[model samples]
Target chain A: MSQKSEGGLQEQVAQLYGTYVDMVYRIAVLYLKEPAAAEDAVQEVFVKLMHWLARGRLQEKEHIKRWLIVTTKTTCMDELRRQKRQSTDPIEAGDFCSLPAVWQSGQGPDGERLREVHDALMRLSEDCRLVMYLFYFEGYSSAEIAGMLHMNHSTVRGKLRTGRRRMRILLEEDRE
Target chain B: MRQEDIREYFRSQGPSETQKDRILAGVLEQYEQETQGEFHMCTKTKRSVSKIVAIAAVMVLTTVSAFAAVPEFRDWIGGQFGLTAEQEADLAASGTLQNIQASASNGNLTMTVHQALVDEQGMYIIYDVDSDDGSAVDVSLDDLQFQASESAGVFLYSIEQKVLETREDGVTCMALLTGLEDLSGQEVSLSSCGLTCRWTVGETAEIQKIEADLTGKDLWTGRPYHVTGCGLSPICVKLDLDGAERLQDSGFPDQVAVEVANTDGSVKTIQSVGSCGKETEDYRYQMFLFDEIIDVDRVQAVYVDGVKLN
Candidate 1:
């Protein structure tokens, strides 16, 4: 690439950093479950980003969100692979169940509620959890989610509706 | 807690803004160590078009990146040009859109549809039209169009398609058939029916000049283009490429991508340039739609060599 193009690439990556750094961290932590490991994973994602740009693979700006989330998940899985845990076992193996020390470490009622809700969300089945995150937090449609996750559109819908139902039940139970 | 409360909590928990800078700095530092460039934060310019819009309104900005990848952003584009959200939903849910891989074989030319992207922008069929006999298809905007047999949806017809690449077997390109219409639950087909000219690599582009409001240079040609106006409301860019249109038709180079920086320090990338209006004899008028919108007054469209167009 020319120097000018490389400069543009640098600028685009910098912009991506400001916009997606936190989301990338949250996504990495959602799977890695540790701030330290998640932080490390965040670094890995951007490194992958440099490669993605170098190859001229990104066609449009809208793809950054999906690319970050998907890449973080894949990179986290690679990290998990090194740990010898079944990388595909998102919720079934109780991987993300425990809330990290810092998140629950906040003081008072709001903190407790945050911890409880976080725990409950982490405990939902993998498909439901991912569907819920992509839908509510990331703002992806069921159709877009299906395309990204490589699942049927209807299945993504089912998981999302069911995910909400499951979360509602868990939160309602926590109140009682 | 309600689902929204959980959502709020999920959104709330993450690295702080300062930490974001640090982590990103560290990542780039590591990348530099690995790739070996003069890596530093102060020198880099971040892509900020969507970020600025995102900060002002999350709901509006999220859906663009959250959906279309640009072509999927057709509705947002349509909504700008007078299409309703309900209409967009109906078209999306119609499911009448067809995806056929059928091939069109002429004596030395063959056109095949790899896939079709249907959204608010209508149907863009990415196809391969190649000639083993080394025959070149006319790259003019007027000579190409769609021939719909059966229809359930609207079809705003056009013959202009941007040929992205020319491969040994065929050329990969995208054709925008309509704006208000779509292929959703409809029967549509595109062919090089009226293609008369054999436009080869050495062929010159026929982009003429048009009248406009604002004036901006074509950077490469040093010729001023008549830009009617610049808007941040769904951000429309009208650039009349005089000598530069040659690259679009032939596989030559017109290298015209820009980053518009707002006064508030946000940058937006302008790509996938297409025509929005008629052609002029001395200029090839084209427009690029940026994904996000800015407050027009504050927009500083930064070009190469610090040429700012507002």
Candidate 2:
């Protein structure tokens, strides 16, 4: 490759890295629940991107972004799966019910609600949790979620519906 | 309880500035480290390729008996032409050949000749040949003329050998012709500014095999390649090996087809891969093609055909 072309590609990569680093890291943190793991996941995503660029594989910018998100999601999922496999016992029902200290320290109604929502989210199935994150946090539509997850739109919509219903029920029961 | 209420609550509880700054800083630092490692790896690959070329050149210069007498002369020739020893040996073996290799850099073409066969009478006759292994080949042609074909928008050549290399702007082609005893029965004709000639002899179906090692690269990500004149609308085809589907898009009017055929006879066809939008730098919409199916060990190969459109 010519020096000019190589330099331009490097610049584009650096710019893209700067643009999506936050999104990637947040996705990782949400999935992994550990800041250090999230940091590693973000690094892994960028490393993969750099490899793609060097190999002349990354053709377009939008495609590159989509790839990074999907990869980050998958990597996070795989880490979760591995953790699940390593543990002999499944997480009990009360695992997510236990509130963090901050929530119980005489916080406001919003803080209590946030804790409830967070607990309810943790009780959800992995797929439902991912759908909720993509929808609520990532601002992805059902169609975009389906594309990102490689699932049918109807399937994602169903997951979203079921997740919302479960969360609502959990919160209502807490109110009672 | 309402969806809007939930959204409003979450928005109101948005991450604090400190949290956002910490997350962003961590991410940036990680990305920088990763990018540095990748740059190091790429430099290593280039160095390895250069080393292989150097070793091959040394082996050829030391072992070849025919070119031993003219050591200084050979060195001079090698230095003047930037020919490695292996490249020189291949050229010595092939009497006449033509080849082209193209690569894309800033929307321009970088062409290099690996081999050529020069005609004794005119030195302009060229025959581009295909090698079993897709690497640079040696040619015997001395004088060559290169001109761009208006019809095909590809570079064409008139050499001593009766071969034509069809190359895109940024690709390189190499031809090697060995055991050139007689030049009879071989005919060279220039129909279009680009050689509209067909392969008269040898294999009728030249299956150009391309192997992409995407082991480390994330397969879920979409990658787009410009495939013109595929004759059919882009249809994603699944290969037999793994049921992974890949997106295929036909740029403009040309049909683009991505098919995966495995030895096991399993086949999967990917639907619409992704949407296409106008590129940031150009007016052309960048197409998004991705492998929809996942959890596979690996992908063997991907074939894109633009022959029908041509």
Candidate 3:
């Protein structure tokens, strides 16, 4: 790719850094379930972003976001594949259940509740967790989310219902 | 805990600024390592670069003008929202459309509020984002939110649909805000960070409401549905559907296609974008937005999936 001037490249990076860095990190954490791995994924995605900027392929903010979302998800998926291939131990649900160390290590006012919620979230399947996150947290309707995630609308609703029910049961079990 | 609590829990978790800055630094370092020698070696002089940029700008402008002249504001609303020309005219004649000129700026980015089309259900805000410093405008409908004036008592609104079109200099966005109490003639503020614009929602178009409680089976899916409420105007039809828990069934259809039987025995189809189903604790609430507005006085009966519910 043809390179932009160093100053121009820095400006683009600075503009996107504050806006999307946390989002990229959070999405990576959600998918990879390991802060260290997620951080590596974030770096990879940003490096790819630099290439996009150098190529002048991105025209606007919306395009950048769409690209980031797809790229981050793909990066996490590739990491998961690599982990599965590398691990000698059996790949199981418990293997991917770690909440970020920040939430697990620190106990604030809402720490216990946060842990409970995070634990329940980690227990759900990856698809369910993503659907639930987009629906409840991001406030996207099932149809809109289906378009974003490229799933059937019915499937989005199904995952949401299943996720909600499972989270409720898990939280209740934790309380007991 | 409730769904809102879960949302809050996730929302509160993210990497801190220090981590973000570290990641950015790493990215920049990697970029420099990857592109160092090639970048400086290929760099053009400032004068030649500016000449090329100016030529490219003129060519881009010519191409933009030749291929895609920005549609007039009303035409944009009609095209974006799928309204017909007659429907657009009816909305204007009924005083449902208002021209609004409100704007807010943050640094190089400026968000301008242009016009609003209001109905009994909600309104569509037409706006555009431009960057004065020639940077790419990076705003989305999710970034923009509406809050009623303090006196309006904490009203809630949902963006049902958004249409974005990229233009030469900026991005134009039309957002349909629904699921709110009547906002007619009420002062509301829309803001995204430092960019804020306040305007009064103009007088809503006078539309007819048909209180519907008709239950029928969908012929295509053989599933049952209830029409809880409906609104009619010369330009649009808003129908609310309650699936009564059948929405959870696999293969449940979203779009409840409606065919309006006119009084003169002609049938005019009220095209739907699709079924927008939002599940609640007990029922599935589906909203049907018709693309074409029809003559309300002539709509004798409305049929869905071959079942008449009028």
Candidate 2 ranges beyond 4 A from true positions: A1-14, A59-61, A85-106, B4-310
Q: lDDT, candidate 3, residue B10? A: 72
Encode model 3's per-residue lDDT on B155-197: one tens digit a residue.
5445644547776557777766654555555677777535888
lDDT (CA) per prediction: 0.52, 0.41, 0.62
Stretch of 10 with least lDDT, candidate 1 chain B: B199-208
Residue-level lDDT for A155 in candidate 1: 73
Q: What are the per-residue Cα lDDT tens digits for candidate 3 across A78-97?
A: 56755654664533434543
Look at candidate 2 and tell me the lDDT of residue B91. Answer: 28
For all predictions, the C-alpha RMSD in Å is 19.4, 22.6, 20.6
Tens-digit lDDT string for candidate 2 (B70-156)? 101212223323544433322221221122122111212122233222321111222233333444444333533333222143322
- How many clashing residue pairs appear in each of the predictions shown? 21, 40, 1
For candidate 1, give the docking quality class from DockQ: incorrect
Sorted by lDDT (best first), the order is: 3, 1, 2
Docking class of 3: incorrect
lDDT of 1 by residue, B193-266 (tens): 43322210110111111222335443444343333433222233445444534433533322346666776888
Q: Give candidate 1's total backbone clashes.
A: 21
Chain B TM-scores across candidates: 0.33, 0.18, 0.58
Q: Which candidate model has the greater TM-score, 2 or 3?
A: 3
